[model samples]
Target: MARQEPLVRAASAVRTVVEQGADDGYAGLEISGDRVLLWWKGAPPPAVTDTARAAGVAVEVRAAEHSREELRAAADRLWRSSGVEHGGQLQAVKIISDGRGLEAAVRPGRKSPLAPLPELGVPVDVVEQEPPTPTSRCDDGVPWYGGLAIRPSGEWGGACGGNENLRYTCTGGFGVHIGSTEYLLTAGHCATVGETLLDGAGQYIGEATLRHAEHDLVLVRTDAADRIWDGVPGVSDFTKPVVGWVWTFPGQSLCYSGATSGANCGYTVVKDEYTKFCYEGRCWSDLIAAKRKGRFSVAGGDSGGPVFSLINNSAWIQAAGTVTGTLQQTDLLGNKTEWVIFQDFGTATRDWPGLDTINYLDPM
Candidate 1:
């Protein structure tokens, strides 16, 4: 049997009426069920009314500044007259007018029935909620992990091609003192040959002296030094210690970081061989996996953000790895691939066959 195309009727009917000696305005159209709704910025010409009559569409007119209730009443009447018993498929034509311009949208009807109106005399005002803080306590001290908190200082190009200026954004991943003075770790991609890191004030901090492209790890050096801590701390007198290494394990609780989403704590889903294909090299392997679920989380701009673990009373801690991949899925079980992987200092040296000779970082 031949199938028929589903009907796509207009959401509402519209007609325009213009005031004499005023410029005639145009109407916006929206579709809902079999009806087409019309909205206009100013009074429309009588021609608009003739056009609607020709199309056999009903028309409703309201002042440009009609209240929500007033608009709803008109729509309800139109919906009832149209014989649309269920409100779910109802559509509305909305119009807004400023002296200079007009805008319109065709909106689907409310999914659910409107809730009972609030008490008539009650005062109401909308309030926005503040975001939760991302810092947490660990053995070393408190650390900033999540949110779009990383601020860029300055940028230089010339890494990928001939004098190509690469815009560098400032992040917390570069020159992170893991354990040893010789092995500074950061996002591999960030350590491009011609790139540099800048501070919040746009001062040059370090140069991308070394990089592991496959694992996306970079190593750099700077004159500044500070003691790294594990947990979130208030103002204190404890001298900050330099972190050389971080201990991590499978299923250990840890935090994932990025510039925009900030930090989120998730367990190590897996710590096995993670093979990553690079844009210019063979597949790389052996990366850590950190997973978390929260409203504020990681995204693309956070590629080299650090993943940290707190353990042993927050006394012993080290960098587990860097974020490399993110996965998107249509189902909860993630049966499909939506993964984003990052290269870290250790993984880059370990996986890339030629990286050790090129960048001087020892194999993990």
Candidate 2:
């Protein structure tokens, strides 16, 4: 990250100067290698050109053919068709204003695309990088995934599921009930359909009945109902028992529990923008951002853990959702920070139709 920090700082400085002329022709900025890339139209004015050169960082300026607004619209069009399901070739899709117009920054899949990249209506910028390791899956040496209990979110279930010769460990968050059936919620990457799950003590707990990689969620058939809602800790000793949930507001505080880092108490919902979580080229799209000031919002083995907000000084909590993955830091400071990206369980219920209840926390 030694090369990344200077780019971030330089980007901040450049963004201030360029975005001012976005109405004129400044398209956008991107970091490629060790330099900051700026896309703009026409020749630079002395005042603006001098400010950019004085930024004290490496910079690359390109002549953009289209206006910023036109490029933005093109990016939005690509974003809309990202999930059209062309044999899952699109691992991730991001809009970047390029010198020509817009570039769809895509993480290509292992398999080839059924359709051509030009069909997306934007130029495809294939990113070359290694996929993330399966940190949340059950491993023989690491036992960092857990916290199945409702009240304390303590360590109990993690690293579950098995094939003929492989047994993996992963955290199973609190329980949920729909009509007469109960299920354990966790990340889909933890286990596949038909795989059996185990607890921390290696006890048989459930079977993986449902998994949606796009949402990074799995539903395990289990008898572990929601336990007592004794309540989660709050700021300044303001504790409240979680009774129900409300939709996420912009500036609320959200927390989560997991095995590696145990209980992560304080994190602010600083961003609520769309996010992406990819695993080994495969991806789970349509996520939101949850961030804390200092430390990471989540680490390995923390996947599938519940994200909730304490209400008032009481246990009335907002049922946010489960942790998905981390977001790439997009600033110039090279300040690598962790962002706990999650999908709202409230919005997720639409996928599970005919269900009597969805994401309802069990009472003690």
Task: Judging by lDDT against the true structure, name the best candidate.
Answer: 2
Tens digit of per-residue lDDT, candidate 1, span 1-364: 0010011111112211221222343323333234444445556566666556565444444333332233334433433432123222222121121111111111223333433323322122211111111111111112222111122234432111111232223234523432333323456544475566553234455566666654556665544332222222222213222233232322334554444344445443332223222222222333444444433344444556556543334432334466654534334764432233444334543443322211113212
Stretches of candidate 1 above 4 Å error?
A: 1-170, 174-184, 224-249, 278-284, 294-296, 312-316, 330-340, 348-364
lDDT of 2 by residue, 1-364 (tens): 2334345446656654544553466655665665667767776566556766886877777887765566556544555555334343444443344545433333435434434444534354555323333324222111112244111112343322222222224455545656778677777777778876765444567678877777777887776433212222121112223334333323345666554444565564542233343555566665555566554445565566666655435344445677766554434765655566666565445456532223334421
The global C-alpha lDDT for each of the candidates, from Candidate 1 onward, is 0.35, 0.51
Q: Which predicted model would earn the best TM-score?
A: 2
Cα-based lDDT at residue 285, candidate 1 = 32
Per-model TM against the reference: 0.41, 0.54
By summed lDDT, the worst window of 10 consecutive residues in model 1 runs over 1-10
